[model samples]
Target: MTKCEISIKMMNSTTPSPSLGYLTAHQLENLVKEHHRSGWKSLHMEEAFHLFNKMLTAKPKPSIFTFNLLLIAISRMRNKQHYPTLLSFFNQMHQAGGINTDTHTYNILIDCCCRMNQVNMGFCVFSGMLKRGWSPNTVTFNTLIRGLCSKVDITDAIHLFEIMPKVGCTPNLITYNTLIKGLCDSQNTSLALEWHKKMVAQGIQLKPDLITYSTIIDGLCKEGATEKALELVQEMIDKRIAPNVFTYNTIINGFCRKGDIQSAFKLFEEMNEISITPDIVTFNTIINGCCKVGSFDKVSQTFKEMLARGLTPSVFTYSSMIDALCKGGAMDKAYEIFQQMVDTGIEPDSITYTSLIHGHSILGQWKKAFELFKEMVDRGLAPNTITYTAIMSSLCKEGKSSEVI
Candidate 1:
């Protein structure tokens, strides 16, 4: 498993030149490292196999270092496409020589298996590692924990975490973060908080990172614990840990959901005081809240201010605006905004078209409603069943049921 003291020029991407003669074992290992560092997707992947084949053909043979690099490179592949290739190469390494698998080798195999969602295979490898006296490291356990959490198997994830200390795998911050994220994702914010407290108690000197704080705050917000979420925000401030845009957005969105726009505005102004420019999510949350309250005046003000700050409205923004106008019976104004939405290259979705059509129908402008229906289809937007029903309802009210047929 020692690195051979041999160097070879690495290619960003090039075929192995035959005229260069058979590459030494070090050259093959170096090439694998280069392919890995440069991104496997960007390299001539077949060349890696070719080089490995050539490597196995050389005298003194490619050592475990060569295959280890190759395995690491294969692990970096984006998806399941190269999984077979990875396993094939791993098997080939053992057959090429009587070289025994090392801890790193087992670790790589277990990690790759878990990544491919082959957790059973990963566990099999884990068992073999244990039987072979290869003590599992924190990385080994962390990978398993992450894979389990990804599958939302929180019971097993927590179970595995509890056994870490017993197995000499001290749960690191990353391990705690994984558990916290899993709890939050499962919407068990109360449990997430308990874990957070436990993590803090164990590592007082290790301050909670921003991601940890944000996850807890977002979980609380989603649970409608706006007041408690605010308390956490204050705690972050007191600890001299600045709340980023996500933190502010979470709290602000929670307040908005509670229809506490005044408090939402207060935080909005505070973000500016701290020089934290609001992102699209921030503005969308506020705009959506205003739409819920039928506060067109406030919605317009926020929309204008967002534009003044050079923030372009996302699809959420435009839909909120059009819906608010339609609700208020401002069909003409809504139509104007709808045109502007497309003029600015923001295509209206079904909600946008439905709002405009409903507004026209409410205003008794049946001609305009039919025109919008035609335009919607012309734009290649598939009108959902509700949109079709809205138009039918309008025609029905106007005694045009025969025309509808």
Candidate 2:
């Protein structure tokens, strides 16, 4: 009774794969979860849906396990910009009595709703789940807390956080991390620190993770408490909590913004000594600092070092180099790098083009400047107000405004 012709077309699905009919429902469910658990970009949501649909063609249609698997796949859908279809699927499953809606099912649904910023709908689901005598777990609380924090509803998030213990669900590390990050983002680092202390005092967080420390360090650094951030870094190191690229990048960026490039470089060197390979962000940060300090040689060396480590530089990297070269009055060198950037398939953005155009205009190279300006426009990049003013000023001074008309 299997219908090969019965195909469900998902218009918004990024990877529209065929319904996998080869595997059993259990195997299909396992594969779907494996894909979801692998990483953010690993799961193909459309294919998972298709597999679930494919399962319906057989006897003993997908159990709650398979139902939850489809839900999990939908929750981790990468193309969040697409219209939400998970709720529709949930409703279909619920109406058809295909499977029993358990605590896990509601948890997934609530998490998905919350992630979509539809926290009210998620709460409705929670109320329904509770009415059915299902006990909500820490994940249920964490999902809502995290969602509220995302919407800058720190007060509600805190209210929920405080009531977790009262509701028979203890606060986990994720609970604290979410609130701490929310407070830090609201620039209320003092209160975040208080919670951090409370988390430690509870003795539950005896072995805090990188996020726990990094969140506090990020807040301290933003508050111009770089010294305090450094102390936390040392504490993290002492506790053997290895700082990831993001953790180091945060502190390095803070130093660079504070105009303390020397300290940034020192931190960069420390990262190497600690066997933490620098990421693209790390190199980009240092490159930016080098540009500000007019250390062109160091900038070039860093670029080479980045390549030597098998890391491809970003569009920002090439753009920054071109800007630095232009600022140094080396227009020919800037043009060379710009060409190289294009050859590497890195199209220059408005800022990069403006840097080159302004440099050429300053040196009375009107033809070259105009060409760069035209190229920027032809590429569909609308010139900003500053870019237009700078280029117009150059052309008007050269009595070439008429030429534009």
Candidate 3:
């Protein structure tokens, strides 16, 4: 049977099979307690289902807490594929009828629904929680808000944020952070800032954390307000919140996008001064920026520094360097870098291949360019418009204009 069919079957059948035998309520409780203490690190889905079945037959049945522990373990599993199974098991527990489901249990179900992208169902679960006379907590509101945000339903998310206080749930730092991030992600950075201002006004207890600063800084950067982002960085430091490598990378990328390589380099140096080790992303952004301005010397220097820091170069790292070398008319160096990338098990994407093709075409090496084009196609990479234009340009330069099509 398919997995879904099995889940349906499990949900409908609560009668304990005689062959599996039964455990006393104490034994089942101890088993769940042990797993809970371990943070469910080693609990497998099959073992969880087995425990649930055993619970069905245990004398006096396990308490709701024990059942919730098993459910929590399932939810915590790294593989999200089991989330549906968790919901199924919850249904089985509800249908069997004696255990009084608690607020925590409803929260878990609501979370599962939201994670599964069934935000409507999550709201239904919320309504059920209210009907059950269970008070929704901060986690409950946060999960629903995050779900709405994930769907880019910022209106509903904001509405929910406004109603939390009426429901006797005070919005916490996490709640504010989630809404801020949602607003920023939806390209409403201005409104996101308004919310940030509101968060700050809520008193010292609701002070913005590092995540809050970093997220808004990133949004500002994306909106081409690098200077404003820089000011916020200072504001954060003044508030005793140290910016991490990701924060620096975001601003550096913004400066690079604005074609202000000088400012990008300044941030790169500031990271060194602050003892925040530059990560691969930092080097890649610097290298790409340097490439754009034909600053090959800086590219070489930053790439060497990245390797010196024991960071393994990603495909993007190799691709940027290859493109830079190709554009600089250093075909020999570009070819060497391409080979090195392959030897390091980094596959060249269409951009990488297109760069090499264009480089060879510029050098009047039409034959070599065609060979790379064929290789790229054989590797299942589709030639984009730029790639086709490069080949046509090479053909036209070779006095083969008739073959341009």
Q: Which is the leading candidate under lDDT?
A: 3
Q: Rank the candidates by lDDT, best first.
A: 3, 1, 2
Flag the better candidate by TM-score, 1 or 2. 1
After TM-score superposition, the amount by which residue 42's alpha carbon in candidate 2 deviates from its true location, in angstroms, is: 10
Q: Name every residue pair that clashes in candidate 1.
A: none
**In each prediction, how many residue pairs overlap at the backbone (N, C-alpha, C within less than 3 A)?**
0, 0, 0
Per-residue lDDT over 87-200 for candidate 1, one digit per residue giving the tens place of the 0 to 100 score: 666666666675567878888887787778877677777787799788998888888888787778899899989889898888888888888888888898999999888877
Question: Against the true structure, candidate 3 has what lDDT?
Answer: 0.87
Which regions of candidate 2 fall more than 4 Å away from where they truly are? 1-62, 81-83, 204-206, 307-311, 339-346, 361-367, 396-405
Tens-digit per-residue lDDT, 128-209, candidate 2? 7899899999999999888888888888889998889898998888888988999999898889888988877878444467
Name the best candidate (by TM-score). 3
Using TM-score as the measure, what is the rank order of every candidate, best first?
3, 1, 2
Candidate 3, 1-405: lDDT as tens digits: 002122344544454444445679998898889889988877767777778888865668899899988887787674568887887887777787787889999999888878888788788878878898999999999999999999999999999999999989999999999999999999999999999899889888799999999999999999999999999999999989999999999999999988899999999998989899988899999999888888888888988888888999998998888888887799889989999999989889999999999998888888888888889999999999999988878877897656544
Give all TM-scores, in the order shown.
0.83, 0.81, 0.89
Model 2: lDDT to the true structure: 0.79
